[model samples]
Structures are given as C-alpha cells and as structure tokens.
Target: MTTLSSATPRVSPWVLSAFWFGTAFHWLLLLLILMPHDVVRFVGEGQKGTYLGVLTAVGAVMALVLPPLIGARSDRSGRRLPYIRLGVGVNLVGLAVMALAASALAGMGGFWVYVLGFLLVQFGNNYATAPYSALIPQLVPPEQRGRYSGVMGLLQAVGQLLGAVTAFAVGLLKLPVLVSFALIALVLLVPALITLRGVREEGGAAVQAPRGPTLTWRQLFAYQPFLWVFVTRVLFALGQYSVQPFLQYYNADVLKQRDATTSTSIMLLCIIVGSIVSALIGGRISDRVGRKPVIYVAGTAMALAALLLLVAPSYPVALALAVFFGLGFGAFTSVDWALGSDAMPSASSYARDMGIWHVAFVAPQLSSAPQGALLDWGNAQGGNLGYTLVFGIAALFFLLGVILVRNVPEMVGRRPLTQPDGNL
Candidate 1:
C-alpha cells in the first residue's frame, strides 16, 4: 500500500481534478431532505424534531470515531488509494440502499429502513472522507491551502446547482414520497469513479495497519488543537445549522410563500451562484492577503444575512439576503477545510487529527436537534416562531465563529510558518 510518500510534492493535476469531481455530491447529501414538514411526516406522529436531530447527530457521532481510526490506519499503513476506493464503493452502495429502503417502506412509514440506509451512507462517506481528506496536507502546499479550500468551496456551490436540478426533476415526477433519493445516489457514482481514478492515494500496494488508541477518555483528550476545534465546532455548527431545518417551514408559514421549495430553491440557487463568485474572489484574497481576514469577513456576513431573514418579506427579498449570506459563506466555506488542515499540531498523525475535525463537523447534528424541537415547541404554542428563533440562534453561532477563529491565525497565505510553533 502507498501512503503520503508516494504522491508528488507539487499538486497533481489528477489529484486536483479528483477533488473537483469527488466533493460535489456531499452538500446535496446533507441538504436534500431538510424540509421540516416533510421530515416530520415521514418519521412518526410525534417525532419530527427528535428524528431530524438524531439523523443529523448520528452522522456527527460517527465522524467522531470512524475518521480518526481510519485516518490512523491509513497514515500508518502507508496506503490511502485502496481505502479511498473502498470508501467510494461503500458510499455508492449505501446511497442505493437508502433509496431502495425509502421506496420499499414509503407508505408503511418504514422509518427504520430509511434510518438504516442513512447510517450506511454515513459510514461509507467517512470511510472515504477520512482517508481522502488526509491527502490535503500531503498534496497542497501549506501556503496554498486556502486557495485549494476555495476551489473546494467553488465545487460545493456547484453541488447546490446540481441539487436544484435534481430537485426540479423530482418535482416533475410526482414520485412516491422522496424515492428520488435513489436517482440522486446514482448521480453520485459518476463523480466517485472519476475521483477514485483521478486522485491516486499515496500507497496502493503495501500493507501494515497502524494500531490506534482504544476507546477511552484519555484517547479522546490526547490532541490539543483538535480538542479546541471540536469544542468550538459543535457549538458553532449547532447554532449556525439551527436555522436550516426550518427554512421550508418558514417560507410556508411565516413568509406566507405559496411554493416553499420554489422560493427557497431560488434563494439556495442564489447562494450557489454567489458562493461560486466569492470562492474565486476569496481564493485570490487569501492568497494575496490572508485567510483570517477572509474568515472574519465571511463569518460577519453570515450573521447579518441570517438576521435579515428575520425581518424580510417576500421571496425575492429573502433571496437577496441569500446572495449576501452566500458570499459570506462562500468565503468561509472555501477556506474552512483548509483552515482545519493548517491547525494540525502534527502532520504525521494528519488523519487522526482531521478525524477530530470531522467530529467537530458531524457531532453538531445532535446538538442542533434541540433547535428544531424548539421550533416544534413554538408552533405547538400557536405561533410561527420556530424558524425565526432558529435563524437568530444561527446568526449568533456565526458571530462566535468569527471571534474564535481570530485566535488561530492564518497559515495558508503570506508566508508559511517555518518554526512549527503556529506563529505565522
């Protein structure tokens, strides 16, 4: 098996191409079934918020454990490509299973099957995610991490475009429940294959798995930056994502929009377009100036945009807010992954470290469930305050991120920090 040593120092064209192809489907996987009413109806009579929260939470919790283990094994085994291949293959199967499961038990409220498929998707996604992610530090030059992250941000925005198209087709089919999930899963395969081919992992033929820490409190608390990042990540993400679960609901009830999907779709599409623009601009900005400024600007913008939705009337105006938020988010998103790469206290343990970062990402799904429940609680109280309350909370989370990120200065621009002390 081959590991980090095998890849060329300069960014491989094939590797960059792989990133462009591989990551496009991830956003859709998260955003596709986010509608409040739809999710609630599918789960159970009294279990919408809890169901949605658990679904989101499970992904995070899995990330917490799986990625680090996979990363450690990959890093030590000196083979990344095979795991990447394996992970992609698993992801494809999981998506197919999810679609099939959802279709089979649609009317019967076969929630377990759906949940089962979702868990499979989570497993497969990180199987690839932890290993493929470790490659960032290996392939991308330290100073250029931000630009690469921007490139990723560009691809993420593009994914939203793909999702809009995906949703449109589903709307036309008048399909049974959300069975179109299968079609979406099928679409994911193309990119996975291309990426698997395009980005060759460092090791493909050697075999020697590195032993990792067993489950224990000590093992969990071993890393410093990872610990700090995870602490901030769960709190911040829960707050930021608190609003997304309710967007469709907000449009229907609070905004009085007739077609919730159409209205939100436009806003989401605008976010996609605006994000693309910001990623390009942000790439240059991070390259010329630094990542901290970009992150600060983006985080601040998110707060303002979320706050705007609180008072905005009409879909067009709301989309206008999306444009602003998208720009901010684009800047942040483009470099967010790269920032994680920069904060590594030890590159030898890159995968393990990144797994912690992944935990920061996935764990929040659970914390944010309460935010959704809060909405359900409000709605039961004879008001449409759920969405508004969530968005306000999300704004606060964004602001907090802005504050926390400043302490971790930018390492992806200007000059590479030579001392290894994290002082850029």
Candidate 2:
C-alpha cells in the first residue's frame, strides 16, 4: 500500500492555516457588523431584515457559482497559489468599491452599489478559499489531519474574536465605516501573504496532474460518501445561517438592547471564547475517538443551545447560550473539515471536490433568505414570535445534521492518497 512520505518536513499548523484567519475575520465582520449596519442605514430598521436577506442571497449565489469553476481551473493548471493571489487582489477591489458605495452613494442606490461590491467580494473570497482548503489534503498525512483541522478551527475562532473586538470598538468610538473596511483589507492581506510564503505543496511542487479524465456529473453524484458529507454540511450550514445573519437585529428587537452593536459583539465574544476552547480540544479528540462521535456531541450541544436561546428571557441568558453554541460550532467546524477531507473522492481533484463541498456552506444562504422575511412576518404578529420561529428552525436543522451524519462511514485512519482508484 502507498503511504505519504514519513520524512516530510514539519510545517507549523499555524502557518498552514493562516489564511483561514482572514477568511473568518472578513466574513464575520461583514455579516455580524457592517452589513446589518449598512442595511439599516439604507433601508430603515423596519425593512432591514428583508433587504439584508436579498443582498446576502445575491452574494451567496455568486459565491456558489464561482468556487467550483475556479477550483477546476486551478486543478487543471496544477497550481493553487496564483489563484490565491489573484483572489486577494480582487477581494481588495471589492472592499474599495463597498467603501465608496457606502460613503458616496445613499439609500437604495448605495445599497445596489454595495451589492455589486459584495458580489465581487464573494467571487474573490471563494476563488481563494476553494484552493486554500486543498492544502490540508495535500500537505498533512491522514493521522495528523485531525490536529491540523483543530488548528484551523482555533485560528478561525480567534479571527472571529478579533472581528468582534473591532466591531465593538468601531461602535463604541463611532469610527468611520471606511476604517472598518481598511481593517478588513489588512486582516485579509497579512495572513494571506503569510500563508503564501510559509506553506508549500509536496516537495515545493505543484499539485499532481490528473492521470484520467475528470469525473462526469453522473459519476460525481454516484460518489456516496462524499454526497453524505455534502448533505450533512448543507444541513449544518442551514442551522448556522438561520441565526447568524440576523443576530444584531435579534439583540435590538428581542433583547431590547439600547446598544445592539455592543450587545451583539459581546454575544459573539462569548461564542468565540467557547469556540477557542473547544477547537483546541475537539480536533485532537477526534483523532483519538473518530470524527462522528465528536460531531454527534457538538451537533447536539448546538441544537440544545439554539433551543435555549429561544426563551432566553434576558441578555445574560442569551450570552450563556451563545457560549454553548460556540462550543458546539467550534468542535463541529474542526471535525467537519477532517470529515470532508476523509470523504474526498479524488486526490487529484482536491480543489474541485473541495469547492463543491464548499457550496454546502453557501447554498444554505439561499434557503436562509426566506428567514429574513419569516422574521419580519413573525415580528409583525407580535410577541417576538419571529425570534422563536427562527431559533426553533435552527435547532431543527442542527438536530437533523446530527442524525443524518450517521450515514457517512468513518474513515479516519484511512488515507485517500493510498487509494489510486480514489475510493475510500
């Protein structure tokens, strides 16, 4: 049986996972802070949820379409770094456009401009991320993947933490929106540069070229384990998006916080703290006990936390549930990557396959777009019923994810590289 080289040089997991920091930071900052603020500024608080949903849905569509094409292109070219570089450049342009739109344009016109910028951002981010995700499969051995995934989760959580802090400071100090946009650019650029310099493919070479023709759509769909992983991920993302995009509004309308931004940041801080702790622990534990168990526990915790948040009664209770949710989320994210890596059907098509898997993450936003309208309608009926309905649905998604994940067979110690046929 073939095995990866035992003598491969050890690269720091932090260096390997550096770009994830930027990825997590920018998305959290945009979703949790800037987008909500801008939507309200443009559309008014009454219709902010609906407008935000439309914008996110549009952006999500762009995100869904770009990555697979870009990934496939990179796979055919047998190069990933150039795409990453190109993506970063494009992402910065989007940020600049968004800043100008928000500052110069006004009302719905500005919103439309902002949407154009956002679509560019999605295109660039996904272009980078699809190839970037292949690094673990290319670099790390099967035995070490769980630990590497843990590091990824840790960095992602920390990025989110920093994003929350930035949001808090921006709100407290009344910092200009451009400052926040500049920070986003900085966060994305620095870590991406680090990853570009610090990481390398096997023996400092490009990815191996495919020996056979690429899988057809029918062949791809026939890959059962990969499909299971995709389905499970879609369900999990559904749970996450159902709540994440509307959190600031939730604080304002449900908790009645005078400072909704600060409250939302505080809640995110709790989630980040819990995530940091669990990410460090969960990835390593999965290496020992297998991915499914960790996912089971993590999914259950998240579902319960979402349920608890439904009747949280006060800000403090919501904060506590956020931590619990974070713990689950962190563990799930860490193990989730490892699981996806394990289920990869083709070693040569790593980027392309990973990009398809990534769609699971963004596709949920399409389904979740309705949530914004659902929230509005429920709130219109009084008793903060929208919050209850959304949170309940989130919990259901989480629970379903936990149950459906059982269909994916565990393949933790089995290395995909060993199988020339690309069958796990």
Candidate 3:
C-alpha cells in the first residue's frame, strides 16, 4: 500500500486503470450517444446554431457553479469513492436517456424529449465530473502527477476519437438510436465497477491537517500567479473553441471538400494521435526539464502553425498544419494540467481548488461563445477573413500564454513528491 498521510494508504495501477475506463466510457457516450447526430434533427433548420449554443452555454453554466461545490462537499465528507460510485450510476442512466432520445429521431418524438435528454446528459456529466476529478490530487502526489495527468490526457484524446468513429458506425448501422445509449452505458459501468473494487479512501478523519486558508477565491486570487495563469487558460479556451466547433463547417463550406465527413474523420484521427504522443512525451520531458520552458515552445509553435492552416490552399497542407498545431497544443495541455496540480496551495480541498483552476477552461465560453458572431464579423470583411482572424486571435492567446508561464511556483519539483502546503 502507498500512503500520502499518516492515516490511510492509496495504491496505483488499479486506481489509474479505473480512471482510464471511466474516461473512455464518458467520451464514447458523448460522441455516439448524446452529442451531435440526432438532437439537431429536431431543431428547425434555421435555429440549429442557436440551439447548440444554448446547449453549450447550459453546460458552461453548470461547469462554473457545480464542480466547486461538489469538491467542497467531498472535502467535508472526507470521502472520494462514495462520490465516484454515485457519479458512475448517474452517468450510466443519463447515457441511457440520451440513447432513447437519439433513436426516436424522425419518429413520433417531440422537441421536448430531445431537450430533456440532452439536459440529462449534460447535467449528469457535471455531477459525475466534479467529484471524479477531485479525486486526482487526493490520490497522486505532485512528482508523478505529470505522467499521470498525461496518461489521462492520452485516454481523453483516444476515447473521444474512437467515440466519434463509433458514432459514425452507428450512423451506418441504422440501429435504433437507443442502442447508442446502451453502448455508452455498458462502457461506463464496466470500468466503474472495476474502479469501485480497488479504490479505498486514504486519510483518517481523526488526523486531518491544520486546515489551510479558508479565504474565498476572490481574496485568494489576489495573488498574481493564480490570476495570471487563469487568464492565460481562458484565452486558450476561447481561441481553441473558436476554431474547433466550426471545423466541420469550415471544411465543408470553405475548403469545399468533396467529402466533408471523410475529411473530418481523417483530420480528427491525426490530431488525436498526435495529442496522445505529445501528452506522453511532453509530460515526462517537462518533469525532467521543468514546465515553463515547454510551455514557451508549445505556445510559439502552435501560434505559427495556426497561421499556416489559415493560408494553406489545399486539404493536405491544411491537415499538415493541424498536425503541427496538435503537437504544440498537446505539449502545452499535458504540462499545463501538471502545472495546475503543482500550483495548489491546499490539496485538502483539491477539487475546489482544481475547479477554480479549470474555470479558466470553462469560463472562457462566455467570450468564445460568440464564435459565430466573430466568424460573421469576419465574413462581412471578406477574403478568408474568419479563419484568418480567428487563427490570429488564437495565436495572440498563445503569445500571452508564453508570458504568463514565466514564473510558476510549484508545490513539488517534477521528480519527487513534496507537499509545500504541509497537508500530508
């Protein structure tokens, strides 16, 4: 048994495997069971963008409010497995609901049924997410967190990539839409049950550390590093989504790809494959060399690559640029997650603090949500303006990211576990 505190011990391989299983299940469901495909069929043609935005905005809102509260509750309860168990159950059922709604597409279903199902999937995702993520800091010490976070990142990219393929397969199968949800549910349950088996909680209620600062985030964030890093992440999320949500549209409308679906399938596969390699390699490298140096390189590389995509005349060149961007994006993303883990002043409320950190990812939706408006604004100005302008905007964020990464203080160096906050 591996122990973090004097109270109880946590071990690996089992816990980590469990994490991967749940990760695969979650993304698989999103692409195949819940997202895209059928829900939009119900939206009147003209209002599809508005409806999708509403869907995204709703999830963003939940992302902002719920995760921190759930984290705090887990801290208060001094338990992680119970939360994980409950989360897995809800996630399975939510996928089941979404499958039902998807199969009903073009059938006698009403709009409300689709809306209800999407909401179920999204809301349940939040419920499961908040607690599950909170468990990471509790389990892994900082030295190993880079490798661990990288592995999780790899799982995420692969899971989502496969999920999209699977969803497309379902599209081919002409299977009842509900079967898609059943697939998601099965994937979610299998690993979740395996996860439950080996996940014994660490730490004793009797030996809790002297509680760290109870200061509200407003007060705590007065420290510059937190504010600065958070801002950088926000910018990255804004720029990232600005390009991503519309990539299919951009390919179809702008690139004039003869087969948009085939092209997108190829592009996503390449990007995800690159992301997996980058995460695995970058995490280990940063741990050895330090985090900031990698961030600087990633930011610059991605900035340049984004511009290359904007100007590429042919699909092959554009895809090449995407692979370039993926390398930089993956490096930064792997290290960035590790960096977030290192920056925490308190691991006692690991989820709460991590939630605050991740708000950088989620809150940017408010600004980036108007990607359509930004694209429209660019189109009015003409001459490949939207992609050009958006890529430039994303590049600027990467540039700012370089500046923000300069002096990140860490709780531990990447090679050894150290608790600067004295929680252990």
Candidate 4:
C-alpha cells in the first residue's frame, strides 16, 4: 500500500486534476455532438437513435473489460505516466481513424468503420483513466480528498463547457469534420502533457512492495462498503446515461429545433455553467460537512430536475431544468471520487480497484442502449412517449442512488485499510 508522510509536500489540486479536463473534453465533444451528428448523417433521422445506441453499446464492451486489466498491469509494474502517454497516442490514432471514416465514407460502411475507431478510443481512454483515477487516493490524504475532488469536478465542468462551445461553433460555421476531430485531439493532448509533467509519483519501497495478497473477486465482494459505493454509482450513472445519449434527438424530434446540434450545445452550455458553480462549492462544503449529505442533496436535485424536464413546457424551460440538473451532477461529481476512495477495500490496488469502479460509468451505456430502441418505438407510436419513459426512469435511478448511498459509512478522517487496525 502506498503511504503518505505528514511532511510530504502537497501538490496543487489543479495540477493533479489537469488531465481530467482533456478527458471530459474528449468524451463530451464526441458523445454530445460529433458521434450523434455522424450517426444522423450515416443512418438517417429515422434510425439515428437506434444506431447511436448500438454504436455506444458496442464501444462500451471494450470500456468495461479493458480498464481493470490495464489498471492491474500498471499497479503491478509500479508505473502510471508511461501508460497514460501510450494511451493518449493510441486514442489520437483512433480519433484520426474516425475522422477518416467521417470524411471519406458514407452509410453503414462508414458507421462500421467508425465503430472500429470508437472501440480503440474506448480502449485507449480507459487504459489511461484507470491508472489516472488512482492519483487522488495515492497522493492526497483523506482529509483533503474533498478539495481534490472539487478541483476535478471544476475542470470537468470547464472541459464540458469548452466542448459545448466547440460543438456550437462547428455546427454554426459548418466546419469541416476533420477540423473538429483535430480540435478534440489537440485538447486531449495538452492537458495530458501537463499532467505527465506536473504530477510525480513516489518511487521505491512504498510502491514496489506488495502489501499482501492481491484481492480476489470473492474478497472484493465481501467488502460491503465498496459494494454499496459501486451499486450507488451504477444507479446514478444509469440515470445520467438515460438522458445524455438522446438529448440531440430530443431537441430535433420533440422541440422541433431546425439546428439540433446548435440547440444541444446551447443547452449544454447552460448545464455546464451550473455544474461549474456547484463543483466549486460542493467539494469544499463536503470537506467541512461530510460527503454523504452533499451527495444526498445532489441526487435529489438531479431527480427533481429530471422530473421537471419531463413536464417542461418549452425549450427555454427545458434549458432551465438542465441547469438544475447540472447543479446536482456537478455536486455529485465533486464528492463521488472521494466517496469511492473512502470505501475502497485496499490501498495497494488503487488502479485496479478504480478500474473496477469505472465499470459503474460504462455499464450504464450498455444498460441504457436499449433505450434508443425504446425512443424509436415510442416515437413510432406517437406523442414522443419514449422521451418521457426514459426521463422518468432517470429520475427513479437518481432517487435510488440517494437511498443506497446510506449503506456506505463515511470514512472521512479515518485511517485507510493499509493499517492493520484500520476499519473501512
């Protein structure tokens, strides 16, 4: 297990969280705008939702399997930055391949080619992210985790905001698809470079020695706090994914927006604004008050916002509801990493544990993939009932997250499981 000394110098939270901006930028741009736009172009409006769902679902398979394996490899090797660098290079290659498919091909052939690229992107991103997720737990003390998590949330919100702006510009100006892809690669590269340069991992005995046996699946499941955290995250993510992938379609089909891309970007801008504010506030507040209280508030806010969005009378009203949703999301994001860190059963396998935790994020993509068909079916039946059904489900998931989180006891200021007498 990695241990921190009281005399160890503290790194700035911003420096530690720098890579998150790039990560958030890459995914938000791809998921919220680029991929959806491409799916619509390739598959036509009638089947866009179904096609997009299938593509994301297929890509999610790679996302689910690769992270834990890569993370375990990095954990064993006692190295992280090299893996991050390699992952970035592979991710860029995937992005370039996707650009080629978008620019050169048409129809299902192009979509299939894009799918291959998406798989690579998922694999590469998760490869980096699994190890990267260990930084906070490895570096920061328990008392300071809330502040570090807050910084992460802040950067993520900013990244998403920038991604929204980029999407809007691309759609409004009719920029070449390659140009947008290039922008994603550029944004992704810079922050990763910064993180590689700025953050330093402790070397020698602390990292090289195995604390004990590597945790088995059975042993992992026996840790009730970790299980609860994983379950709560899964439910929260399900609610989020249910709404996220279908927003552009919602704008076009339900709101009758002529330029759905631009509209979605605008809505995202509003959401990100709310997220930024809450992220900055929520993390600091959690440090003082506790993680669960903040999470409870956040989940309720999101659940209410989801419900409100369902009955929103107009596009403007929907945008307002989106801001409310963002507040909850940002607050949740701020404390989520800290909570997971607190619940982890082992300190020696930070990356591996975090990689398994990451499944909570991608599993939802797989779970919610069928919602695309539901959206199509509901639209086919008239009144766009699919949107309502999905959003309602989202609300339910959020509420469940609020409830299940209670099972994980707060470990703030407590000694981690690395100590023989420590309790999780």
Clashes (backbone N, CA, C under 3 Å), per candidate, total 11, 0, 1, 0
Q: lDDT tens digits, residues 62-179, model 4?
A: 8899888998988787677888999999999999999999998677888888988888898789889888887777677778888889999999999999999999999889999999
For model 2, the local distance difference test gives 0.85
Cα lDDT for residue 55, candidate 3: 57
C-alpha displacement of 379 in model 2, angstroms? 0.9
Candidate 1 TM-score versus the reference: 0.85
TM-score of each: 0.85, 0.95, 0.84, 0.95
Q: What tens digits encode model 1's per-residue C-alpha lDDT throughout 1-424?
A: 4545322334443445444444564445345443343455576536666667666666566655788789878767766667766776777676666666555657435666666666777787788777777667666656767667777778767776777655655555666544556555555666666666655443443222222233233444454444545565665576656876556667777788777666666667777777888986786677677767887898889899998888886777888888898898788777777777766655456666677677776766666567767877877776567666778888888888788766664555322223433321
lDDT of 3 by residue, 193-301 (tens): 7766666544432234224544467754765555666777776777676566556556765688865545665676666666767866887777777777777888888
Between 1 and 2, whose TM-score is larger? 2
The list of candidate 3 runs beyond 4 A from truth reads 1-9, 17-21, 24-34, 37-40, 44-47, 106-112, 171-176, 202-211, 376-384, 414-424
Q: How many backbone clashes does candidate 2 have?
A: 0
The C-alpha RMSD in Å for every predicted model, in order, reads 4.4, 2.8, 4.3, 2.4
Tell me which of candidates 3 and 4 scores higher on TM-score. 4
